[model samples]
Target: MLQPVPFPIRKECPPGACICERERLLDDPQGDTRILRLTSEEEKRLVARIDSISTYADLQHIEERMREQLGIDLRISPGMHEVRTVRGFNIQIVERPGLCRKTRQSIPAAIRRCLDKNPDIAYAILNAHDLLRDD
Candidate 1:
């Protein structure tokens, strides 16, 4: 089932300054990029929610909500995930794609850099692609 995640209210910013996009070589291990400017709380909540997903298909629903509510510009790659059982316990493990942000050096850096710089502007980049689909 696809649940709707609320989109955080964004403060007004200059036109075309809300988000940024960058492209890397197709052969590069990392995929394309999308930088989203969010608040500290919003970033944490979003990441936590995504991390909580137990299935790739569920992540796809979140991605769809992001595009619908947030904007079509943002990209979300759910990638691959699996659920396993052990000792009557079920665990879901997912391989998250690379997420990063811009650095003072103008090079792409880890997402932590953005979180460290300004929690208010939770700038994050998400590698948007998928390896599976829902049946």
Candidate 2:
């Protein structure tokens, strides 16, 4: 398989390894991480999706609203999630891919229901995205 990092390697990198981009440089005295560079099409898609969303329409509302408000278009619909604070009481909802999808409509509701029904949970919050996990 083609490696994400260039082959033939280099002396600077440790032998038998090709670290694409570490979150932190362990060997370097000053740690550094690369910033994301999104493609034009990807940016367009994101804007299109975001345009469609609204307050109560669920995360999908953002995407739909974006499309309506702007000429941009998107083929993919991102996801959303709800999370509980460290206290395990307060709730905050955020958008995340692992949390929602086109076919999966019950994630937010389920989270809200779980929070509302669970006396132990004081509140909950959503995971904004899985960007860190996504390659």
* Deviating ranges (above 4 Å) for candidate 2: 1-37, 60-135
Let me know the TM-score candidate 2 reaches against the reference structure: 0.20
Residue 13, candidate 1: Cα error in Å is 11
Location of the lowest summed lDDT over 10 successive residues in candidate 1: 83-92
Off by over 4 Å in 1: 1-37, 72-135
| Pairs with steric clashes in candidate 1 | none
What Cα-based lDDT does every candidate model obtain? 0.33, 0.31
Question: Candidate 1 vs. truth: CA RMSD?
Answer: 15.8
Tens digits of per-residue lDDT, candidate 2, 1-135, equal 212332222123243343323222323444221111222344445434433333333434543543454222323213333333333322233332111132123323343354354423221122223423323
Worst 10 residues of 2 by lDDT: 96-105
**How many clashes does each candidate structure show, in the order listed?**
0, 30
lDDT accuracy of residue 103 in candidate 2: 13
Provide the TM-score for each candidate, comma-separated: 0.32, 0.20
Residue 108, candidate 1: alpha-carbon lDDT: 14
* The best candidate in terms of lDDT: 1
Candidate 2, 42: how far from true, in Å? 0.6
